[model samples]
Target: MSIVKNDLADNSLNDPHRLLRNMIDQVPDYLFVKDLDCRFIVANEAVARIHGFESPDDLTGKNDFDLHDASSAARFSQIERQVIRTGVAMIGMEECVVDAASGKERWLSTSKVPLRSANDTVVGLIGISRDISARKRDDFLRDEQTAILEMIVVNSPLHAVLDRLVRLMERQLVGVYGSILLLDDGGTHLKHGAAPALSQEYCGAIDGLPIGPGAGSCGTAAWLGESVIVADIASDPLWKNYRDLASRHGLKSCWSAPVLSHDGIVLGTFALYSARVRHPEPAEINLTQIATRIAAIAIERKHAEDKIRHMAYHDMLTGLPNRSLLTDRLTQAMLQTKRHNPWVSVLFVDLDNFKFVNDSLGHTAGDELLKTVARRMENCIQPTDAAVRMGGDEFVILLTDLPENTDAIAAAMHKIRAAILEPMIIRGREFHITCSIGIATYPQDGTDAETLIANADIAMYKAKEAGRDGFRFFTPELNIKAHERLALHDGIRRGIAQSEFHLLYQPQVELEFGRIFAVEALVRWNHPQLGLINPNEFIPLAEETGLIVPLGEWVLYEACKQNKRWQDAGFEPITMCVNVSARQFHDQNWTSRVMHALGETELDAKCLELELTESLVMRDVNEVIATMEELRKVGVSFAIDDFGTGYSNLSALKSLPVSRLKIDRSFLRNLVEDDDDKTITAAVISLAQKLNMKVIAEGVETHEQLTFLRENHCDEVQGHLFSEAVSSTEIGKLLQNQQSRSGLAPA
Candidate 1:
């Protein structure tokens, strides 16, 4: 190339061919200049080389129609006409063309500009073209990848992430079709997720493919936890057996990569199949590895979520539904009952005296006992009914479709009681426990969850108050009594401050002599407005409201003081019997309370007898015996109050240290006429005599009952036949008169 002086001085303008030729040679893009008749006038070296020509001369003076197929020529003409008609440059026109001389297809991205003379007449066309085959192929790959990504994301719920990676490699690498085979639940089989598009029939045929060393490509990959390649499916042992099926579906080769969890547990395999025998490209292998990692994360996350949800609703201690889930179920059940107007019952159960067992036997034993109780409760209810543990020692049952009447509920309660009371052997020790049940019915007790629970709780407490190991229904009367108990609690507190309580004496006399043998000390509460209240009304109220401890102390102090006064007034010492409630009897300070009362009043312990009901003695015989022995050491005699009315075993009675058994007044009410009553009394008297224990016939109001008691040789008697429970002042007067008449009073 030679440079001229004019060209150097005015580089902007020069000979047209020289300027065009220089621009074409300097540009990296391929450029060509064509005349109006479509003959190539000039061509850049890059354009010549792009068409596999050795020199520009070979490309110049040649039209696209001479070098291209009709389809390519038509596309070129369309671009040239567009530029000439608009007199504008056509930018970035992409087309695929087959080189006429080389017979090879190449993609060209071309831009054409209209060439004109100085007078503004169209002279020719100038074109710029780039060999973009690589870019075009990459773009095609990206579009295919995007479509496959969407398909996997939408279809492969189990292996979407891994399936997409496999599909991407299959599209980007030639001669490859993809498959994702996940391990089945048994861990011995491979199940297809997304299979090769070309081998659909083959994949379907081996959908539930087995896994082993040489079962198949996917099976071998999963078994070895590595990649497996069958370069020729017909010859490789891994697919030797499946060669017929593969040949039928036009599959000749397969490659597989093991899909594994983060911990290296084989989850499945990612496989690719080829219609013609071939090896996997490096890009395909790389994508398979990436997909395996993603699959591991997704599968692990799903499994973790499921495990957590399972644990949240179950109790770890007993494998039962915990309080949270159980309550939710109960609320739903209540809603169903309300909507359907069906019968439903909620049972509130509390173990009877569980605290004692826990305290005496340590918490380990207590825990074991609770587990045992949970199992028994689960057995007691129907499958439709739910037995829920509301934490320690408390259980609630939601029962539906109960019988029309409350009898079924009662029967269920009894069954529950029986189940719980069955003896349990824990830590080589046989233990027996019972439960107190409170039942609240739908619509009758409450319609809502909270109201039903509250009513059930109230009824449960009522069961405890009525002496435990029993069941009670929620009733209006119980609610009234609960309110009255609250009122009495407040009243007792006020009474203690105002000194409104007093003691009365009920005379216990010998039926033969009409002489007083002992005096039963009873408590009286003067309510100021209500005049006087009997002990029966306030005593139980005091016990329930936990006011008995203080009230009982007051009674002991007042009774001992009264007894000492009568003795100081020269009347003979008479045994004063005081009723002890179960609550008071269970108090650890009871023995101390009695000793303090005796010391404070200077009264003899021999003259004081503590009366307890039959049920209290049967609760824990050994503990009761220990308590009785402690009291006996201080000269306090014992008596069983209202005997023959409870579940008292004859063997247990023989072992107790009680001095006398009081026949319940009901038996004596018609003792002379009713054969059953007479027989009961006779048996009691005979048993007492045989055991050398004294028998007291209480509530004897008539002389006929008195005569019958005398004939039966009953040891002592106390009732209306002698006198009613009277005030202390009247009791003192009667004692003085009796002492004077017997000539045993001071002169």
Candidate 2:
């Protein structure tokens, strides 16, 4: 509102001078009257105290330039002159001005009215201002926190968010610089998070300060998990170690608070440094607290998200890239191969007999062994290469930047095998392990991720079959085999479903009497298109594709049914032997399966014998024996087939509850000349008899071999000597012939 002509003379109160002065001084707001020269003609107590004066008389005749810094005083004089010259009243103008008391910026809601004389001529301005510094500071902090939290929720760049935070903190405190120092990944030293106000040289000097008691304010705060306030860096004992550095940077006072996560984890530190040596005010402390809380939220959220992604893409046991990561990297490598590296190799590395270790040493030690192997594989590869764990004991190493030479690839594969073969010390015992690696290269072993991995897997199995520890590259022939294997697997599945599979019985003759007392039921798949498919091809494929569980069940039930039929037909009673695959043997429900077949066929468990290979028995001897004992209790007997092959030491034989042992055909095929084979056969028979288990000989095709078996006192024999495999009706005829020759009854 404009001043009126009688505005200064309207009051008629008694003792007006002292009354008006006391009233103005007690208002708790700054009030003053300025002359045409912008000098203070009258001042109140609030105005005096704000300008660093004890009494209003001290500022009575002083100008704005005398009470404030030149910049602030000039701004004030310009605003007040407009009110005086235009005779206009400016209302509610918020402006920043220097506080002469603290030498810091303060905010004011100021209003100025032009004063007029009795003639209505403008004279000077009357100023009234209310201190709004605290309110403005709170509003600024609220707005900034909201903005930073929004950024954090949206997953903004961490450095950018923290930079804005540091600058916001610096804005509230005069001459105070702000920094946020993040703890390094190792949690040992500090790394720069944000330091927008600090000099580059100073920031670099303290970037990696290890957190400790006397390692400056930020470092000590981080180490102690508490706020550290060094009021005077030049003389404080906490800053004694860093005093020289502080002096070089003109930093005199510092306050630092540890930034802690919600779980009390130390994420970093928030620090405020002042150029002048002084204690921090309440406002400074409040900003430090708010800034640290916000920083903790930002850092902890980042760390939590990062940890989530890590767990998703990495194997839990070995901390290596899992299959998903393997596929991703393979795709990226394939895309980059033509532009960058001459070749990209995907090595399918599988540990040999990992299940044996896992069962023998317990899963705990097995996990330790896997972790050790993973580390060795990592060390064997370059930084550009990735070592991924593809579940269980399988791994894949992706190699980039390879020379197109076969020799170099061979060298790399050999190095990896050598590293893997080194003894790993786990849980206070040293153990040896080996890996079979299959190499599939870019532009040669198929182009896509799935095909390359598949080819490499095929090559790996081939290497395992070649020997225990070896490396082999994928060949075109291997792909053919792989495709054929896939076809056979599918065919066998369809064969079982469509009744294309039937049984052929090979008679196992009692050696001393020459009577057919038992027959081994072998499976034959008769495809409608390709004639009879070989068991030699499909058996292994069925096992590989996990179709053995169903196929073996069918074989078992069919064999028992055939044996029951023969007995029902008034033939001599005989044992029916069924070959069990390694996969089926390891199944948890395998015992139940055998019992179910016996019950369904109404066959005597006594006449049914399950034949397991020596390798399957040795895979996990304790578990195998436990299962064998369970079956043997129900009157079903077990036998070790292929006794001379695969883990054929005498140590595992004596404890097994086996009723018979079968010599593998490989030993019998060359027993006429190979002394080693003869010795092994004789030893196996002797070992079997000593364990009170009757032994049988397979592949005995000649009378000489028969004589050899008789010399060894073998209990039974089965081969082409009597017959190959025949049909059920032919088996019936063979059984009748045996009975006629021996003149035996159906007993």
Candidate 3:
């Protein structure tokens, strides 16, 4: 037990075995030999020191289980046994181990070979291992970075991504715990984003910590928009407020970096804590900055995604739930409706005279007024109820989990009405507006979202009908009407499919010669079971159900075909007039459909005149004129049906390709009695004559009405006065005898 000056003494040198052992002990890498039982037989100074031994002799006869953990010892024994049994070498095999005393992870590149006896039989193993922890650590960091970015690309939850982030940091710098705290929307407070390595008690205590100059590491870092380092939490002025909490969690130091967005706004903070009171090394500081950059990306991306989602589900102007969100909530509420007291109610609120405001004060002022009304409605409801903007001046208030008591529901409706009744200023003028609300309950009025909304809408119209500024619950009578309407809607589809509809022709008498000049074709539905359904009864229903397009097409084709058949039967050719629905007139393929009908029947375009309501022509004058011009090229002309009943622009009317104007029956009904009706009818006839358009007076039943129209120089007249819309065969017989009896009277 003696030593020389950095060398072995004379007595040690004399023993070659001692000199060789001394040289082997000075090797830096761990070198050892084990017997067949996996017990240490030889060891170097590095191996003994690493295992916390004073000398190599301390490790002799000891095994890995005695110096290291059971798991590490078992792994080592397994590797050695393989070499001993196979007499093969295991070279440069990377493995991990934990320090027995320090509890730190270390990676080693190990090589083991079988130790053979003189007879060349495997007896033991010789082993050597070198530390490769630093290289392996870098590899781990790259792998983790790739994994975290992949999670971000896939839009993983923010909490999950942050949790994995902190765990990755913990793995990179063993024993140093990590956490992330994000700022509130106001950017004045730090809330826990992730802290899986920290105690829940400690995290909860710091959840809503305010950011200031001296409010702990993460708070101060976020407040100052920079990094904050506190080597000793117990004594640092920044940690004074959180010292006790940190002490309870055994945290003595912390380093934090602000997670700033690309615009240099502080979004949150990334922090690392240690049990030992020491400042961070350069590597740890660099890692914190890396974590902050990553946190900024994830936080900003999450916020951006949230903003887009909000915009999708909410109205932009009113900031209320839109129809999409409302529909979802309504469906969910319907599913949750119980047979007990609590009920889900839909309140359809329509602003009274909103169109008047838009017309008087411009659309911009109308929009502002609607926004004010929206706010008032929102203020009238509880948090559980949802206020939705169903577009335009319409709003729907969804009242959920309410009492079944009708009185209570009416009170709520009263409150909403009262709120909207408040006076408001629009376009610099004080104006008062009121809203009409309709109530429909889930599982009572209707179950589905569309049905509930529609029933509520029908009820709202009923309220307006009763008197505006009132509320009404949907009635069973209204439900019956709705069902009948739906049945008729379906029945119309069946009627068309079964060919239960036919056209009737009414002859138009020429006022000059009294001969039948033309015929107006009217469609009548023979419902088979119901016998006959008037065109007025089913025509509007067809329009509402979008079936008017097909029905109108059938009328056009049949009318053209009948005219063609009559002409081929040796009868003089006459113009065939057919009424067109608004939807059919505006159809993109309308011109093509008309041409198809004419081609199918081989009818001359000049003999066909399409009748459009004045309102339909006035809808879009330029477009309507263009369509009429395209058809007018082939001699197909248009007649303004119900001319005086609509608000038509005379300037635009002058440009229409119209061949005639038919005075509405409403004005003609009282023409002989009411002077105003006579004045309107006469004015329309004079105007059509000045415009060089033929004027036709329909619904001329009485002789007095026919006399008034003839006196006004009406060119053509059709109604019961001219054989009350006879069938094709009867009209054909009339066409044969037109000269003998141009007396077009019912008698």
Candidate 4:
């Protein structure tokens, strides 16, 4: 009997049905086997428990249709048929079912596999089902939450975000309607963001409800910075005043949570309303709080980004568009011009002599001047145009869809000039300023932004040179001239190093006596390639290139040395006059330069005269007077050269330590014929005499002009009447002849 029992036990362990049953029972998931007619042929303990049956026998030989709802049974049949036909395994499909014994709705995740014969012909099916009701519910809730969050973030204007959030929660959560109320600046009022759509009229009644203890659900929540719940809106003290509005809207209960920022500052409150008296679930309250916090972040970020963009494009000082934004607009305009072949103009304007005004007046006045100019420029441009502050005293005007004929550009330039010249009152003083404008047109001047800007800069410099308070159009000739000037500047620097320079002396003859009284020292350049270059050509070049400072010093030393030689050679003490440029005269070290030159040459300070133009005297009268007085005390004299040509002030001249007034060549050129010239010359001579100053007439070409000057009491005359400027060797011979005529032999 024992041997027989052992054989039976071996058979039971190796039998396929017994082995399958044991494996199925060991799995955590519910496992079952069904026949072709869909009856459960075998069932594990898990499967029996899943169906709310007492044991495996309870579920055996029963179809899923007998155990579940028709829909659940139909879906399971479809999956089983698919798996059988394909002889494959199906995985993780979810379905809803009603428990047979418990009569409760439940969720299950199921997988099915075909049980095939040895020849691979399907005969039955094996399936696994899991109790996934908790997981499925959690997933559905997560998707709902995510969708609500997305709606809030995407909708704008903080209020809209709150409105969307309320709608989402009302649809998802049972027995829940909601409202959002934002706090005011003083935290004393509640501004409604959203309310239940059905109760919108009631929400409107309390749209701007005041915030305090017991005012309403939202107000109490905001005041306490915590949840405020009125389980029964009709009876709660918190909703005492709002109960009528709430009852009219059919709201029975209310719960409010403070909407706080990440830093815990209350921004608003979220309130839930129930159709019947009820308390909010913990999950419902938590979800509402999450939505409120997210709304705060979105609103704060939007405001911050808007503030940053404003600061980026606007000029802090004048509240105008700055260079960065202007450049971007200009680039877009240029691109449009290229694509459409339209005419566009860029006007680069620079305030003329603005530095002088800023230095003379205080910074406050300078700032006021800039603001006034900005306003005037803004008024001058059309609506289609943009006036931008390119920084400092520079501004740019962008004109689009302009006329191609260039007349519009000219008119624009005229407007700019007129606007800038309008007098402005700054610090109780009337001030006038002007601008130099450079106009560069698209397609004509350049094809790109950088090239256009460069051409405009060149044109601006040309306008300034032609004289400020005007504008110039970009031209090829102007660009070439700019390059040539640059080359000349470099060449002048080289000229000084190479010592390619010399001096000539023009005799200053006494007009009444017809004898040389003084000699005007003139500079001459003898270029190795271009010989004997005239002063008119290189002297202005030197000044513009700023080479005049060193060149002027050389001339002063040479002139002083020549005067000392003449004095040593028995000639009468004659004043040696050297023309000083305005730049050199205004230099801080000018007085020291003069003293050094006199000391080095051992020339009598009385015999050295520095000649300055009328413009220099009028620039700063007080400073000029001070400078002249200091030099006069050292025995050095001053002369007003090219008189009656600039803005000459007689009072300034009288106060200046001047010994001679040289009439400009314009007045002396036609003194013998032109009545205007003769009158000007005679008047200048009379004026100089009244001030006890000598009068020297320049540019005397003929004996008739010299005779006129002699009769007019002109003290000195310098021109071809005596001799043109000559070399030093020629000057020595002339001095010898003068000494012989005076019966004074050379030492």
Top candidate on lDDT is 3
List residue ranges in candidate 1 displaced over 4 A: 1-170, 173-177, 181-215, 232-253, 311-747
Q: TM-score for model 2?
A: 0.53
lDDT by residue (145-190, candidate 4, tens digit) is 6765675456456666666667766655666777888787687888
lDDT of 3 at 159: 97
**TM per candidate:** 0.42, 0.53, 0.58, 0.42
Candidate 4 regions with alpha-carbon error over 4 angstroms: 1-457, 461-478, 568-571, 743-747
Model 1 has an lDDT value of 0.80
Q: For candidate 3, lDDT tens digit of each residue in 650-677?
A: 9888878899999999998888889999
Task: Give the winner by lDDT: 2 or 4.
Answer: 2
- Locate the minimum summed-lDDT window of 10 residues in model 2: 5-14
Error of 1 at 316 (Å): 6.1
lDDT of each: 0.80, 0.87, 0.88, 0.80
Error of 1 at 651 (Å): 57
lDDT of 2 by residue, 1-747 (tens): 225535544542345887789799889889999888888989899888877889999886788788777987898889889998898899999988776787777889999999899999988889899999989998998898999999999999899999999999888777899999999999899999999999999899888989998889999999999999998999888887789998999999999999999988889999999999888999889888989999999999889788877877898789998777888988888888878768888899999988877777887889888998999889888887899998779999888778887877788788888888898877677777888989899879978887788888988989999996888899998887678666776788899899999999988887877778788999998988889888887888788666898999999999999999999999878999999998798776899999999999999999999999998898778889999999999999988898877865578778999999999999999899999988999988888898999989998788888889999899989899878888999999888877677721212
